[model samples]
Target chain A: MLTKRIIPCLDIHERRVTKGVRFKNNIDLGDPVEMATRYYEEGCDELVFYDITASSERRPIDLEMVREVARAIRIPFAVGGGITSLDDMSAVLLAGAEKVSINTPAVLNPELIEEGARRFGAQCIVLGMDPVRSDNPACPSGYEITIRGFREYTGIDALEWARRAESMGAGEIVVNSVDADGTRAGFELNITRLIAENTGIPVVASGGAGNPRHLAEVFIKAGADAAIVAGMIHTGEYSIAQIKNELHQAGIPVRRHW
Target chain B: MTAIIDYGAGNLTSVKLALQTLGVDALITSDPDRIMAAERIIFPGVGAAGAAMESLRKLGLQEILHTVTSRGTPFLGICLGTQIIFQHSAEDGGVDCLGLLQGQVIRFAPADRRDKVPQMGWNAVSFVREHPVLKGIADGTEFYFVHSYYPVPDDDAAIIGQTGYAGVDFAAVTGRENIAATQFHPEKSGRAGLQLLENFLRWKP
Candidate 1:
């Protein structure tokens, strides 16, 4: 049986591990490789890294960081934030990332999803979405896709786009609710369940996990296969072991390391 | 030297790095001769079986791989590598594979198993029969896996380890003589994965 995945997400800005509220006002954490090693040591099931270095230059992803992190940890991880082309995807996978996630570029040109899946296997591509609250009749999920780090609304219905992305060959989807993000109220269960219920691919629910109980709720109620956690673990609120132990006590099948 | 076959597949570097971390200096090469000359060969895969076979044929490595494995050289195949070593696959609409073992790859039927198709996370691998690759690796230790198709060996003797996905048992590891392959990627499986690689490094068979 496959266990419920508990992921610890981290941000990489200017080649260093950084912390921020949702997506802004950041402070350096430390060396990404060191942090990754510590998390892997503590039995983090997986890691989701976001290169939050906003740039207009069309540069490549940080291959050096990918290699360093890969050398440090043995678990699978997904890297995102400037993956604009298939060549970039290949480079990231070659640098030892198990998967490459596309956000804005995937939305701008949806064909890239099909092509990336066609080139690298669908298992290597993750569809990341930052959605905000919406109640438009056209949007069934009542959530709209937001880009540019949650500043711009695309008017695209979150659930509809999620179905389309699955049909387009996305092996997994990461739903990070902008409204629920950094609020610590918990994941937007409605939106997360909406996406998870409709798509056959694994759904990773990101954002607003205040504690381990929040994760248990996301996995049990929302039907998320994995949780993209940050703030709680980032702020030393709970270690990966403590969180997994709590989930285990809740009768959730989480991998036990210690 | 152990050479990891790179047929334009993902995780070639991770396999090499895992080998390095295990203190075994392995080489990542697509050349046929280097692969044939290596003391041990690790074929790693992360894509479709048909395309991987195409890449192998394009580089003229299919025959060399067959020759080396049949000639009693230790061979380790991961994921698609293990699937391609079988006779046929249902992926890409029924494609023929290397036929090194008596098995066929089939997609996980969710209705039958009631589990996710990809099964993309840590799962317990129980040893059916002990082999050197299982050295120091505890039984039922979870290993990372990311795939939709699981190999169903025609002959039960070749299957060494089995993993249950939603109550359906599938061959997660198989071996016959010198050829040993795992459906899981040991490179990406953390400490336990490293231990398997270390055992493979010293595997006499």
Candidate 2:
């Protein structure tokens, strides 16, 4: 069976795994490479490294740091933040990331999705979307897309944007709810089910996973292929093994080697 | 020397790094000479199967790979590299492939898409029979995979392992004589991935 993925996302800020509530109030955890290695040892299914401040800082992703993390761990890893072009995507892949996640640039220039998939293959291109509720019912999803680190709303309907991304060849979509991000309340399931049910591509529900129960709910009820758990893992509230164990008992299939 | 064939695909560097993690050095090459000269060969591919086959032909590697494997030189293919060893693939709409192995690659049907087409994630595999690659790896050990299409080998003799996805079982690993290939990306499968690669280093098939 295709097991549900328990990915520990490392929000990188200047080479450190930084934490913030709802994408603010930055707090440094430690060296990213070291943290990533620890998570890999804990048996996390995958790792996601987001250069949280890259777009606002106006710089490229830290390739040297990416190389260090890639070398330290052996699992498939995805890198996002400040990935604006094909050159950037290729560089990250060469540095050893299995996939590259694009949020800001993908929305601003949707061609990046098509071009990245064309050059690297669809499986290597991941579309990262930040969605928040919008007023317009005609918006299809009733949620507008946000970019530039969730500071700017693109006014693009989240559901339509996801379908467009898949058409343009995004292999996976990470539907991150800006409203639920860092809130620890639970995932925005309505939107999650809305997007996952709508797109043929696998959907990864991001944000608002405070515990194992939330993870189970997302996988079993929300129809998410994977759930990105950040704050809880970083805060040492639950190890990857513990989370997977809880899920396994809950009848959610997860990889168990350790 | 072990040769890691790079045919304009994705992340060949990471495969080299995985070998390094196993304390094994591999020569990353697109050069047909290096590949032919190596004692062992590892062909890693990611992307469209048609394009992968095209790159192998362009680099003059298709013939060399077939020749080497037939001569009993230990060879391993990963992901798309594994699929290209088959007769045909439905990926780019029934593209003809290297035909080095007796198999046809086909897409998981729309009914199977309930789990998503690519079926990307970690799933356990039970080996059909023990081989050198299964040395330290236990049955049901998890391996990472990312693919839309999977190969269906004509002969059951080539089948070495199987994995079930969305109520459908597929050949996860296939091997015969000197050649072994996996539908999953063992290079990125963490410890189990590296262990399989390490076993490949000492495999004398």
* TM-score versus the correct structure, for each prediction: 0.96, 0.98
Question: For model 2, how does the per-residue alpha-carbon lDDT over B19-137 read when each residue is reduced to its tens digit?
Answer: 98888788988887888789999988888887888887888987898888888899998999999899999987779999889989988775654578888989999899999988999
Best by lDDT: 2
Clashes found in each candidate (C-alpha, N, C closer than 3 A): 0, 0
Clashes of 2: 0
CA lDDT, every prediction? 0.87, 0.89
User: Per-residue CA lDDT of candidate 1, range A41-104, in tens?
Assistant: 9999999888876323466778999988988888999999999889999888888898988888
Q: Mind giving the per-residue lDDT tens digits that candidate 2 earns over A1-258?
A: 889999889999887888899777899899888888999998998899999888888998999998998889888899999999999999999999989999989988999999999998888899999999888765766899988878897768999999999999999999999999999889989899988888899999998999999999988778999999998888888888889999999998899994
DockQ of each: 0.64, 0.80
Task: Give the winner by TM-score.
Answer: 2
Error of 2 at B51 (Å): 1.4
Q: What is candidate 2's TM-score for chain B alone?
A: 0.97
Query: Clashing residue pairs, candidate 1?
Result: none
